[model samples]
Target: MSALLAEDLLNQMIPPLKSTDTTAKAARWLEEFHVGQLPVVTGTHYQGLITENDLADYENPDTQLAELPLRYADTYVQHDQHFFRIMELAIQNRIQLVPVLDEQQEYAGVVTVSDALAAFGPVPGPAGQGSILVLTMEERDYSLSQISRYVEENNAKILSAHVVADEHDPFRIRLTLRLNTDNLARITATLERFGYLVSAQFSGTAAVSEDEQDRFDALLRYLSV
Candidate 1:
């Protein structure tokens, strides 16, 4: 599946009104859209966003929406930004909607979690863009240290490293490394010298080998199951 773009996910027509808007109107919009948060805009510029929590303190359902506290997002993505990045932003902030802006900072639209989720499919994204390396070693191995040492020694950084027991063989552990480097042969050679057996390397590289594809599939199945 392909990644979604902020522009593709943007709900430009669903812009939220200013704080000066009546609480009743805002509530109605929330109900109509079924969104917990709405992006507020003034003319063509973005002002802030209003969330459902801000409505809690209001005793009157008839209260002025503008009177509700505004919760703003410090990070807003331009319309040109990738949808995957938008999803990350939403998850990090625990918000559902992200306001999209043009290069001129004009309010272009909004990226909602629902739209993004639908576009991108299942997430807490499972082994999508980065590289994955499968290093085979003994159960007594301090896998992380070995991988870190080799990665750093190679002038590339390790984004993440993990160790999982070889399901079919408990005595062996599969050390997975998400790294900055894509050179499989070079990485494998370095680790092999340190007594680590590199089973496979998976990455976002255009040309994925058969073994890499199998490992990628294995990762997805593991994550889902």
Candidate 2:
């Protein structure tokens, strides 16, 4: 799938909070799902996001979500938006999940940050040992020769490159680059200086502790289902 959209990565298992939902139920859902926040909606119309901190002060566990102040009411993406848009919303709002909207700007579902990063990180290729970087730019602005020259200037080589047309914008494209080095600090900086958007990235050379490795292995096993 060249173009992976936000709708494709939606985690439907996480339900939205309605106006009548109480603070108690919201707290329980947050803890149950291990998420810091959840989207609050009134039918198809998305209201905002409710977080754990928003519920801590309310003395009444029965207080309705509609009664509390919500943040990031307008933070959401459309069904046709790319997964990169989901990551942008999540990072800009610092929320665990991003709410999704439909063609009419009505609530469709929610996309978790983890799911978005997971789907956006990897590119299909033979197993290699470098980092993966994703770039989004206008199709007219793309010049593989110029980009390849830039990477070469940094003393690195591009192992593989994958280009995908943006689903929402025909004039735009997404480029996934598998570099021969895990140290992307310089290449990314150089690309940014030249006006390239380094969106989602996967750095493969970080040291992983025993516990972290075990957790990752467990997650892989779970995803295999």
Candidate 3:
């Protein structure tokens, strides 16, 4: 359940410029790269980043790229930052392309809005095609999808999955998967063999034991806790 990092999502080696570069060159880079902004740097150190809106003042378009006031990342992040924070910056600023920097303040890459959306958007959970094995797993474990694929390949169908960060440890996640349970026993065995921390059952005869009374008791306990 290791989530993608901002640096991994960022597009750091973006179109860049030296302070002395001309505005025309900047505009050209913007158009050529099909980007609205370009990060301006000096050597490996980040000097500033500039956008077309910042350049709109210069109708001439011939101004020196160096002369235009360069803007920097208002909420820029280091290269090793979390992806969720990067999403917050893009949504708050209403801009694309989040710049990433190294410890030396040097340009690393850029994280585009598209990448963040792709990574953070609703993704299919385990038991993708058939019945799901809803449970909790250590965040460091990366076999969630693998386990789901195995279930699906064996003729089960995964309905849906919900994942929540563990309250006790952020590094663990509680996953609830809904899967078609035609062969419930086999599915459970497969999941257990694959190292899934099986905590509950949710289908057919096995589900009968977990009726409304049980659900109510569980809810009460949860609320009291």
Candidate 4:
């Protein structure tokens, strides 16, 4: 697949407003499109993002957007930048729309968080059989090369891997992997043997075995009672 760039995800259909536009018009567009923010530009040069809050703070519908406070004048990503940077900027600034700029620093378009999520929501994996494995470890222990080596030793290939910091513990991270095999028993054993904590595993046979064991334990407790 081709690289997922910011430009590819651009919502060019969402028309940008000029600084000369009235706050009432901007607010009407925000309400109609169900977006919290909109890009304000002068010709091709992006001025900044005008948000609903900005309009509410101004409290004057007749006022021009130029007179109001437009935020993130420098908070835009290039058209060729990876989509991840767009997500980062959206999260950091707590904004819904992220402006995209071309190589010449002219406004290209805007990308919405909803659009980004839709583009990246799919689990990256091969078209064939596979299993998912979730592992939790310290941030310092994350080594993709080492983990790939272990998976390879077990005769399994990793189709895709995603890492995210654990919200409960900032020092730890969660690694989710999709392997190119249905059975994960051997791979799980190998990872555990090497001190990798397999927090969760998704496989047909393993799930059945776990369910049976839980049922057996429950039966034993009932009989004793």
| Residue-level error in angstroms, candidate 4, position 78 | 0.3
Q: List the candidate numbers ranked by TM-score, top first.
A: 2, 4, 3, 1
Ranking of models by lDDT: 2, 4, 1, 3
lDDT of 2 by residue, 119-185 (tens): 6454334343466678989999998889999999999888666577777588988887767776778
lDDT tens digits, residue span 1-225, model 1: 232457777776586676567666777798888888888766776777877777666768777655555666466887756554564566557677888888798888888766665654443434454455767778887556656878788777776554555645769766656565545556667888888887766554436777546555544343333
Kindly state the number of residue pairs that clash in model 1. 4
lDDT of each: 0.66, 0.77, 0.62, 0.76
Model 1 local distance difference test score? 0.66
Tell me the spans in candidate 1 whose CA falls farther than 4 Å from its real position. Answer: 1-3, 60-67, 122-225
TM-score of 2: 0.68
Best by lDDT: 2
Mind sharing the TM-score for model 1? 0.52
Report the Cα lDDT for residue 149, model 3. 87
TM-score of 3: 0.52
lDDT of 4 by residue, 135-212 (tens): 879989989899999999989898667676654688987786767676788898988988888986655445567654
Error of 1 at 137 (Å): 29
